[model samples]
Target: MGEFLRMRRSQLQLADVGLRDFGERRRVPGLRRDELAQLAGVGLSYYTRLEQGLSLNASAEVLDALARALDLDEVERAHLHDLARASRRTGTRRRPAPERAGETTKQLLAAFGDAPAIVLGRRSDVLAWTRTGHALFAGHLDPHIPDQPDQRPNTARLVFLDAHTRDLYVEDWPKKARDVVGKLRLAAGQHPDDPRLAALIGELTMKSPEFASMWSEHRVRKWDLATYRMHHPVVGRMQLNLQTLNVPQEEGQRIVVVTAEAGTGSAAALRLLAQAGTSSGAGSARQAARTARRP
Candidate 1:
């Protein structure tokens, strides 16, 4: 809770909170402890203890005040509450069990014929993908990565680690990267004891400076309807709308579908890609099980 609060506080500027500067030299970024305390209507000593991790048990009203003072959005507000609740717990956090998509989820992916869709397990693992889904998104990589549990392709991993994926989202790569980090932040809060998730974060933090910087910002976002401009090596440039739907029966599983406007150039490109996959026998639902090196 303390770390998250501190990071968020640093993200704001004095001007952002409608405070006038006295031209005094200050050391820290954003609001200092005293400024934050005044804004949130709390004592300086009390806010200092909270930020220093010496205090917990913040009441709902106090939390609300802090949330307002920090200008936290809905997702961020929820994350703050979750962190506070977690801090008051006494027992050790348990490890999260591995998760995978079930038969019904696979069937749902299959039903999405021309639409590119994939089932994402907990930690953003590629549990399963429709034929077009494989062709559209990850066809450039070793296709076998999604088939084996141990070597499954995690979207978060690919976003930061794969050169091909980075190229695909060339124009808006940073936005995509930020979204991935935000989603991971929420996932981490929800599953604090997941070792694999922790390992993934640690790896990215070490391997990618961009990931490390964004991670420290403590951003949180809910993955839902999002649009992106993609530069596919095969299909060229196009805009696609992505919608993420949660699998209610399974915990931490979501189906992401990507589509374009019906009559746009992007839609035509998608149709061409789908047709090519079909002509090469790569569009069959059964073919998703077989691995094919991208040509």
Candidate 2:
């Protein structure tokens, strides 16, 4: 929370909030603590304690006022509340049980047929995926890998650590990376007590300088719908729209469905890729059966 407040404060200018420079030659970039306190209609010392992490008992009214003063949007305000709520929890952190896609989710994936669809846990772990989803997203990986809970591929890790994922987004790779980081920030705020999440963050921060740099910005976002241009090793270049659907029964589980508009070249490319994925899956099944018979 302190880091978030400090970063947001540094982004504001004197003219942004109706404050004059007065030629005083300020040392800091944005509004001072006292200035922000005045803007939020709170006591300077109280606000200072809040910003310095000395006070976690701030009321919702006060947080709302601060959010308003900071010109926070809906998502930012929600994230602020999440952070505050997390700060108030007191207990030993527990490692959460591994997440899985339920039966209904699996059935939904099957219903999607040739469409590329993947079920993701709160930490962006690939809980389950259709055959086309595997081909479209991580075809180089073993298609059955998600069956092992301990070895599920994490989207954030793939984006930052895997070369194939980096190459997948041929255009606006940085934008996609930022989107992943932003969603992870929101997840961290929501599950501050999850040890696995903490480890993931630490691993990314230690391994990828770009992840470390973007994570420090404290950007928060929820992925709903977005379009991207991708270069697939097998399918070549195509533009696809990613739609994220939240599971009502399971909290923090989402299904991402990939699609392309009808009659477009990208749509035709997706059809071709789907056919290839089906053929590959069939061949893998046949090979497995042959090996089983030999054994």
Candidate 3:
């Protein structure tokens, strides 16, 4: 919480909050702790303690006032509450049970059919995907890899470390990368004790300098819907709309469906890709049957 507050504070200026400097040399950027405390109707020392992590028992009213003073949006306010709740917890950190796509989730994926869709866990792990989802998003990887927990693809890892994924976004790769980092930031605040999540963050920080830099910025974002321009090696270029739907039954699981406008070239490309995926799947099944019969 202290880190988050400090980062937000640094982003503001006197002019932003109706304060004027009298040409005094100020060492710190943005509003000072005293200024912010005054704005939030709290004592300077009390606000300082909160920002220093010395006070963890702040009430919701206080948090809301501080959030308002900082000009946080709805998602940012929710994230602040999440961080506060996490800090108030006691006892040892517990590892959450591994997340999986339930039967209902699988059915939902099947319902999407040739439309590209994937199920993602809290940490953005690929739990399951439709055939065309695999084809459109990661045709270079093994189609069955998501079935193996140990080999599952993490979207965050792919965006930062995988060369193919970097090329997948024909433009706005940085925006996509920032979105991944921001979501991970929100996840980290919500699940501060999840060891696997901590490990994933550590690995990315060490492996990718860009990831490390963005992670340090302390940005938080929630994915809803977005459009991306993509260039697939097999299907060519496409402008696809991505929508994320949360699975209420399975906490932290979300269904991401990608689509292209009807009658557009991108939609036609998606159909061609789906057909190729179907043909390849059938050919593989035939090869497997032949091998079994020979043996």
TM-scores for every predicted model = 0.90, 0.92, 0.92
Selected candidate, larger lDDT, 1 vs 2? 2
Q: Cα lDDT of model 1 overall? A: 0.84
lDDT (tens digit, per residue) of candidate 1 on 1-295: 8999998899889999999999999899888988989999999999889888889889878988999999999899888888887777787667777777788888888889978999997799998887678877888755566778888988888999999899989998999999999999988887777889989999999999999999998999897998999987666778999999999889889999999999997887676667536445544322432222224
**Candidate 3 lDDT over residue span 1-295, tens digit each:** 9999988888888888888879998899888999999989999999999989999999999999999999899999999999999989998767788889999999989999899999999999999999889988887788898889989999999999999999998586998999999999999988888888999999999999999999888889997998899987666678999999998789889999999999997887777767657667645544543443363
RMSD value for candidate 1: 4.9
**What is candidate 2's lDDT per residue for 1-295, written digit by digit as tens?**
8788888887888798898889998889898888988999999999989888999998999989988888788888888888898888888766666688999899988999989999999999999999889988898898999999889999999999999999999686898999999999899888887888889999999999999999998888886998899987665677899999998788789999999999986786676667556666545544543443363
Candidate 2 residue pairs in backbone clash? none
